[model samples]
Target: MLLCWRDVLLPEGEHVTEKVVRSSTMMRVVIVEDEGITRKWIKKKIEDLGMGFVVEGVFSNGSQALEYMNSHDTDVVFTDIQMPVMDGLELLEQIQAMEKQPYKVILSAYDEFCYARRAMKLGAQEFVLKPEITEESLRSILEEARKFQDQRNTLDQERLKSEGESWEASMRQLIRRAGDPDDIELIRQLEEQGIFLSFPDMILVDIFFDGVIRKKLALELLNLFLEQEQTKGTAFSCSEQEFVIFYAYEDHENSLKQVQKLRKVLKSHMGVEVYLGVSRRKQDCGWGKMYRQASMACENRRFFSIPGCQSYESMRITAEGNPSEFCFFQNIKQIGVFLGQRQYTEAQIAVERLLEAVGEAVYLYPAYVKTMCNEFLVLYLHEIWKYDLTEEEKGGTGAVELLFEQAASHFHLLKEDVLKAVSYMTQLLKRKSGINGCSAPVQEIIKYIEEHYAERISLAQISDSIYLSQSYASTLFKKETGKKFSSYLQEVRLEKSCEMLLDSRISIQEIAVRTGFFDAAHFSRVFKEWYGLSPAEYRKRIILQKGNRIIQ
Candidate 1:
């Protein structure tokens, strides 16, 4: 009625009992009897009881049953003492030597009480003299085995837990991490035939999860898998949702497949997607460097938009070249021209094309994407700001920083942000311009500029007076005059200055002040640049020419 477990008191005054059976599974039975009729009859009785025992193998001799049980799982072995080649007692001894020995039971039809005592001494759970064995007795034996297995499993788990803590403490001496168990959990040190990894020859794998999960359950499942696979490595929790695995140098191909299988196991158990980052063994690479590389690869999955895995060696990196130096200056220049001419659609297209080109690049390095987007943004801001003649834009930073807030590390997000910003700039330019045209609006801008030439005129002031936006006023004036608004205004100021100079009554300083040249020095500089003579020299020469013509 009870499992044959002889308990001994431990130092803590607790009794350590029997071992081996999963109570949840049906108890497996192997019957070994020399008489075929007795073996069949006993097997029929046990199976007919409908108890939690299933007769897996029925053998004519102990040797046959032992061979089967060695390779297969046999929770309970029912054998007769007398058989050919191998007898029941010898079989029980051999089963005891096996790693996972099943519960032993001796079966005999004869009244050999001595054989029963010998089988009990040899660690047999029950000795059944056949013809006396009944269904109720078999049920009691099955229930006892299940109960003992459950108790043993509990003790084993407790032992493993205590040992696991000691293992973690030992690992702490090796890894200098911030003292948070959720941040770092050191597992047992895995030992194998040949693995010290003294040289720089270990592949580090980092696992990343998107959100929080129960780390204890997750990591235990991973540990069980590693044990079953006979994988030798040091594993630890890097964070609540991230783990690290270090393997001695095997080829990356095998390591990759193994890691992929690990991923599958985790997914099957937890129903969560795991992103992986792997680091290869490189020359002179130390632990800190490798850890950083694996961490970088893991985090970069989001920016790079790769869902599964990324290895450091797989990334295309040109060590000598600078990613920030990747240029799209010509596109930037063309965009400026488009904005200046009120080509909003063209400007938008240019922006999209530029970003598309960046996206089309062979390798999307996170740093390069960031650098390229930043450069594109700055250059584009400066470019488009040229066309925005609003008084505020002229004085302020002109959306360089306002648009920069949208910058992101993700390629698609960055591209979307850049396109939106460019589109915004385009719309703003268009709104300021009011309408894109070559005729009436341009003539209005021209008249306004000509009339206001003498009194510190600017496109912003002129556009305000004429009820037009600064951007539209400037663009329209350029289209009408085949020159920029500033150049035309300067020419108008100089023409007025020249007319004043012909009178000779006004001093150069007075002429400069009246014509909005700011000073006589400015007047002279403009005159020399345009006509190769200073203002004073030009005035004297003109007077001399007039006098000679009058005398003639």
Candidate 2:
């Protein structure tokens, strides 16, 4: 018998085989043999040897093996030499032609020695004879093949590591070159590489770390952020212990909101403290302005004194107005600052004080009170919207509703009454503002006119009610509401005239006195301007429309 062993077989197979096979750390294997009985025997032997190989796949013939290889991945392949149409040699050739080839072994009968030799030349890892195969021989061959696979894997891993380092270096170079450029050429490059970079605005985030480990943790946290598809425009670079990220968003305020969200993500995920800064640019401003604003925002992070976001908008002091009248504005500003600092309790107290102050101001200036209240309501709603309440918590009845109720009660403004009043005011302002060449003061004058329209009224009387100089109010009322004060009062009087006209029992002369018109002729002229008909003609048209509806 000519004894042929591809690699040295283990001499003490019974002693070391079980220990090696039972070990947790071992490579996986696949077996391809045409003979079902032989395949079963081989599988049994592999398991019995207690070697650590996990047989992930077993196929009957070479064609089936090839099909399996195409769809599945394995660490090692065990193939029969002389099976059917697509034999071990053809399968080996196919694997070698692939972009990433797997390790291979040949198992054949003694008569196939010549074929096995050819397989070796074609990069078959090792060959084993079937009939005389022993546990010892199998273990040694697998050991040698495992060693070769480890060496190849190490080389491949090193190549990948080198490529990753080069790619990271390229990203840093692109970021550095992007500085001071009129447009970001790197964005075009990234897009060409199938990465998107367009955003309505960009926010630069700089995270400073105290130690190397914390710095790496920060970078990892930012990597998690990039995984979100909505954050595609974001890019990051790390230098030593500092990580800089450029986050892109559609809105300027949205970028600031993202920074606030990032702080919570960092604290919860990484257990690391970080300071964030944001700056925004308009969509048309180009990348140059974006980079400058972001850089400035990052530089300002040092002044925050704690982990938080510093934005360009947060730094400026708003211009002050009358000290006593605008005291509530100052209080709201302080409340906003407290909210920015994450001091919810202090912020709520400030909001309460602002509500109280506005209440006093409204009592002192009842004529202009609605305007003041409307402005404060807008501010209060905006701040409430800014609170970090979840969607579910804010739905139906929640903190927002409670705060609104508090605001109404504090100002002694009835909810139903205020809503009705605001609706009327909004309609009057909408019409007045939409008219050609209307001034803001005209809406105020119109408001005054409506309140006193049922009383004895004149342009001078209406102007005095709202405390505007009569001539100024008169000119503004005409410009804004698109009608002279006298004409607007006449229209109001004529509309009331129509309501009385509908009564059928009331005389036209009595309607004139009731709606603030001087006499029936004056009411007729005004009603004619308003309805394009005299009062009697207007009453007849209404009567005809109503009678026809009743008949139908």
Candidate 3:
């Protein structure tokens, strides 16, 4: 019958030979079958055809074929219906899901034609029955697949031209703008461009670097690392200073290591401080939330975190219940007290602990934490305003507030900037004291008080330091400064003690000893008399204000 068919027709026309020449170039093929003999037979037959299709790979099952597909550019996949590990249907589904979908064909027995139909529905272009697998039948399927590949290649080129503009905008809207993923118009547009997201969970990794990063170098590093990990993640430069990668949560840990390594390599090679933030493995269309978590964690640069790598899981604060409101309120109040007493060091310490506590509260109670931080900022500003400050000092206060406002979601950075503002305020106070209208003797006395406030300062010692009798030095101090020697000394001592309470986490008893109080009990009594709270109570109040102020 074969000889008779060959004798029945003769090819004619230039188009016939041209077509044959065109189809002669090899098309890369991968064959998947559970039976080794059948797989080898199919591979050899495709190679022997000496036409367009050539078997580049032969796998005993679909899983192996899928692995090969990861690194190799496969033009067509010819797979059997049933196989171990991954079935032909599963392979076809994944291939269709790929950004560059390959042509698929099915080989099945007549009894399994129903499965072949399902495979066709899953994006298989053709099916060849096993018993009828002749050279002619095989060539017919391959020719059809080649045509399908040509059509797809043309469409892909057109898509690429528009995809950069359209899909990038769509991605920015979805991930950066927090646009609704369920928006009908958005879904329609993305579908038109064949951008589909099937996974319910996503892992977001944000990269941050100081100064401008070369985009070409940055993308080169990202692609190298992702390809090495064999990840299907997508990345884009969100801004000049930031780049973000979105990967499946199924490969979260592996992707995480890849991103971390990418961070280090960029730093070592580029000589830039590159930081990475990894979001918690989250479910649903959580790209925005994960982006914030990862980016902020990297930006925070907290003490407990390594500057180059921080994960949301590592930086997140966990509380079994809401932190005590009384604690947070007390801390804020203590910060006020420290500021009022001109103890900026202590104020800075109190603010640090306070921010850390609120940082933990942010996840469970965002609104509450925001209110407390704002209120605390107001308190800090009020305390600084009590003194006559220059315009520069006033501007410093405004800058601190602005910094806090900018770091609304990032408590660690807010804490650092606030501390710097308070320190600047303290310097202003010191300068103000220096230019006071007090006489030289009194100015010397004030200097002595500042330097020796933490020592066993006595009137005899104060006068002796300047070679004057106690009574004469006392009169000179009062006449010049309007405050008596003992009163001025007490004021200086108490102020210094308040500074110690705020600046250090030392025990109150130890603080009393260091700050020149012979008796811890007496120090607490005096501290209460001045600030209306014991030292220990003040410290606890500063650290525990997160829950209390929020509740109020």
Candidate 4:
């Protein structure tokens, strides 16, 4: 209708026309029509309605309108379909390809109405008959265009805001250096960039995520936790699967309970465990120490047996005295010997012991475990590569790289990788040799020696098990393994007795009986002859060398 309902209140000639009647769109318009009179009439009707909408340019055909509009910015286009040179439909289609297109309206007569459908498909926002072009009709279309523009503008602003926030979060992560948070210049830069803590005393929470998350989904989950009215803190992603949060230290107990609730919620919904480490409330800017403390707290979760948040005060460092990690190393070395002897069962048993050490040595740093696993693999590959392995057995550096990556992610993966690597070596050795370790006869002979090394064993006893003549069996064993039967038996007995000597529980006489020696005198003589020391002397010297007495 009209601008304001002041028609009844004001005199007849007095009007609130142009100022109040129009929409607030202020949308610029371009008109193209073959009929000059109709183009003038439409322009006049829009002007009569109000100045809130401006007709930027008017043309007799679509081609002229297209050229003028190309160099200018226009918000809307009104065109007639039956124009000369270029039709309204063509102009509408051309405008569709522009980077910033205007709202489109079509002016059509009854006969030309068939093309209106095609024009609308070409991106016309409204279509009106020439005879029906009224101020009300014009205002209706302008208001619709205005509403659409408002919505688009709002979305654009929101997108910009989201991007800027993401960029700021990324910058915060880069600015805060681990173990070096006190750099004056860096701190000043961070503060200048508005990355400082909001309170002097704040609790830092370090978070570690699993891996990837859908950005929108992650944001939705994150907003639920951060935007809670009871929680006053800021959280930002440090990297994929990792984030950090800072809470104004209000109450120590409250902070812990608050973040713990966040962790539980995230874990329950995200289907992944989340760790929240709370640092001892310190001066807010002293985040270097706080960051380290907070990180150390969460690291407690590295042991799968331990779950939930840990605070800075609860962090403990493993001491260096009497580490059972030594026992782990000793067991690791035994694996190679078992594999060489074709004792896959014993080799795997040794592997299980190493993994047990990994699980129990929670006091030890992860790097220590990672190093032990790496050394074990490196030593294994070095030992096996010395043999003329088949092409398949030489697994190359793929396993090496894989183990390294597994160590970085989680120590549990190291167990799996070690098994696979060892299995590959087992396959390699199996292929290089025969079924188990070597020829079937040789394998049986070695098995018999190790099983009964503490008993009175003879070559004839081994031959009977593998169904070979004693002389032939001895020769086959020597040929395949490069050690004579008697020599192999003596080596096994000496190795066993030496290990027992380290334990003071076994007596000299008992050692002889346990190792299948004929007597104490014979055992001492043979042990001295082979090892360059008598049993008692060897035990004393080893204890001295280790700087500790051998205990039961």
For lDDT, the strongest prediction is 4
Clashing pairs in 1: none
- TM per candidate: 0.42, 0.28, 0.39, 0.38
| TM-score order of candidates, top first | 1, 3, 4, 2
The lDDT per prediction is 0.64, 0.57, 0.64, 0.65
- Tens-digit lDDT track of model 2 for 1-552: 111111111211111113222243466677887766677677787878766776666776677666556534566788987776688888888888655466787888856667877898888877777876788887887787678878876886687677775444555545533533344556665565445544445556665443344555666778678676266544454455455666556664466667788778876765556556555644454444444354444433432224566664443211234423333445645655664454545654565565455443321222123333344344434444443332432441232232221212112433233433333333322333343234546655555555556578677766776778888887777666667888877666665466579777889888888888888898888778767899899889978976663333
Worst window of 10 by summed lDDT in candidate 4: 1-10
Question: Cα miss at 436, model 2 (Å)?
Answer: 99
Model 4 pairs whose backbones collide:
209-241
In candidate 2, stretches whose alpha carbon ends up further than 4 angstroms from where it belongs are 1-25, 162-552
| Candidate 1 lDDT tens digits, 184-239 | 22221333323354534577777877666778877687777667766555677755
| Shift in Å, residue 93, candidate 4 | 34
Backbone clash count, each prediction separately: 0, 4, 14, 1
List clashing residue pairs in candidate 2.
21-50, 21-51, 21-52, 438-480
Candidate 1: what lDDT?
A: 0.64
Q: Quick one: ranking by lDDT, best first? A: 4, 3, 1, 2
